[model samples]
Target: MSTDEHLDPIPDSFILQPPVFHPVIPYGTTIFGGLYAGKMVTLQGVVPLHARRFQVDFQCGCCLHPQPDVAFRFSPRFYTVKPHVICNTHQGGLWQKEIRWPGVALQRGDSFLILFLFENEEVKVSVNGQHFLHYRYRLPLSRVDTLDISGDILVKAVGFLNINPFLLYSPRLEVPCSRALPRGLWPGQVIVVRGLVLKEPKDFTLSLKDGTTHVPVTLRASFTDRTLAWVSSWGRKKLISAPFLFHPQRFFEVLLLCQEGGLKLALNGQGLGATSLDQKALEQLRELRISGNVHLYCVHC
Candidate 1:
């Protein structure tokens, strides 16, 4: 199927024009009409009011419902701005604003383009080819399955451009320590960690060392297909499928490691391309345990 065919269709609440209408509002007007539907579109217009706001709806397949994703607010303090695409879930509403180009001012005869790549979880908003904002959904955009555009602002020309899914682009990953294990992991703490698989199926063992007493904590591996198995501690185990290639380097998983530094990771001891600790304030080290459904095997630490 074509790329556009894979994305959600645009609703009919918008208009495209070369001679677009420009509304005149008072200096302090805050409310206005808006265009509320489309996957990928471009809008050009002049701001008659001193300030305005734009809202858009977004949904992911893995998520529950459509949520407000982006808002463009024009103000003196926030001039020439680009809003980030909000992914509702994952990493506490992942913000991919770093991938976007700096925003530009809105002026008469100036053109603006807002491109949404649903299949690839990316949004590019540009003003006159000068990239203003570019953002990517962090957690594989399983939540957003639909999109809607709406807002009230002076518009001169509006155009809808459907994109092919394969043509979608993702911004570079530059966050330092994007997938490091948590420092202080206490009881009842839910943490998620992702990292590249440097070594697959390495021995993952947890032992408690208390004065003359050492015990092995059972560790397991979970395969990618959701199968489970026990990993022998002293065996040369191959966790991932041999001949595994790590292209796209973004492969990782999240672990809900609880208190006592008890590891709750995929069976293969592999790292999820990314890791996130839902709660920031976890207590220091505690005893460790190993027992659970193995999710992934053959992973790098």
Candidate 2:
């Protein structure tokens, strides 16, 4: 799998009992969930073209308002006097000096995903699948009961996942992967695919079907002489093509979010659509099957 496509399996603890996420919010919101040392928090959003700055913080309390001690703060500034990102801590009514990075890979008007994995000694952070920063433990994780996000970014989803030790040590599904869907489609159910597209490949198919009959949906990505993969859905012998393909073989993570309406697509963290379902075939969508040239590392539904 490509480095960009690499993502740790979200585990049963996360997918089945994920933290109550405020899926979509304005530029700011307050989250009230105390985090533990082994928990991971994930957030997805977009950076508008005119964005100047945005921040995410884990604080002592939400009701504490302005004076709560902030365990960690992640702020990315695009149009400030100096374009940079700041990582800092706040305590005793004062903010400490920040650890700053001068440049950023996030593009304006593009979607992004950020993950904060709390460890015993440090908070490891990743942005858009790439390691970004590491902040030493300054305040106790037990005191962090709230998450505050504010700035120009449009928030899409924010949630936390508890780590399970047994799952962590279990065997992983290697390449050429295929698996059965847990319980068919249900709202709030999410299927996550993490893998690398083959560097030199012709085509690949990621599929879902009813165990008794034909495939209800087949995600086919075909390449020609160029480096693009024509991504689309093939079902009931019909194909619907996306306008473009995400860069291949460089690491990719695709998430299929089942909602009341249908499927919400996110490729490498950027959301695509919540297209309505073709109920005839969708209602019976029962099994997940992957057979393609791509190297499938991890799949969780």
Candidate 3:
């Protein structure tokens, strides 16, 4: 996993948010779109200087009396002589056998970036860009909807980001890649492109085309002028111009969500709004072509 220096001070209105969060402890929020493989939960915060212990829980619900089931409980304790991390589940009001990892990676007063990558059968945890541990699922992952963080820690930001679009078998895909879309465009399907802009980027374009070499839609990110252009062939028109999101030598995740009307665009988890294209034009899209200044990491539809 690559780290982006620009990722900190996340965008104010991103799908992955609790942006500029209130410095209050015991933070809780709904995991928008729920838990799924390739989804990432990111938390940026610092451990309180006097912190004794803190826990992050993924729960099925937020019920009080009976207490909703906790699919995953990740707790780090400072009171212990070794300062270890405990991972377990709470089901039917009982705690399951715990798996303890001695020596917590996080230390008091240290600002940290924690990422939880959800996989089919487990969650991979990373702290400050280093692999921390893996916690296998004890309960059905689909049941997780809420994220709860309690105890002593200062939270800066939290984000629920989607990546790897359709779960490619290969970890990454090469740049200037082209793929055929046999079924054309379908509503609810998403196209995700993750990569790093070149040190001196010129521009990049992600386009959808038909067999006759006609491009129906193209999203062009221009570093020269720092603008994102939405191009369409329906009327040979440029739909709109959005603020350029890609930065030279920075990691970026671009998401294009197919909808009945058009595609919803998001950059690095921040929703950039949408554009409307004809459904008939979309249905004729048989190819996805990406080219220009980037080191591609992954691309899936």
RMSD, each candidate, Å?
21.8, 7.9, 12.5
| TM-score list, all predictions | 0.28, 0.62, 0.56
User: Residue-wise lDDT of candidate 1 within 1-301, one digit each (tens)?
Assistant: 8898976543332111111123332212111112222234444444334434443344332233442333322221123355232222223454334322223455423334333323344555544434555544454443343333334455443333322221123222332221322344556555432233323333223222222233222233333432222233344232433212121222333344454434443211222122222332233223333222222221212
Q: On a 0 to 1 TM-score scale, where does candidate 3 land against the true structure?
A: 0.56
In candidate 2, which residue ranges exceed 4 Å CA deviation?
Answer: 1-33, 106-111, 159-165, 171-206, 220-261, 265-272, 290-301
Task: For residues 174-253, write the lDDT of model 3, one tens digit per residue.
Answer: 77899898888889888877777889989899989987889877898878777787877764545344335577875678
Off by more than 4 A, model 3: 1-20, 167-251, 254-301
Query: For residues 1-301, what per-residue lDDT tens digits would candidate 2 score against the true structure?
Result: 7886675554443332233343443333344336666667777778889998988888887654577899999889988665678989999889998899766667678787787888888999877767888889788887887777887788766655554343435454665576776567877878887555677777666677775856555666656632223233452333343333334654455678888766777654445555566554555687777666666656888
Model 3 residue 98 CA deviation (Å) reads 0.8
Pairs that clash in candidate 3: none
In candidate 1, residue 54 scores what lDDT?
45
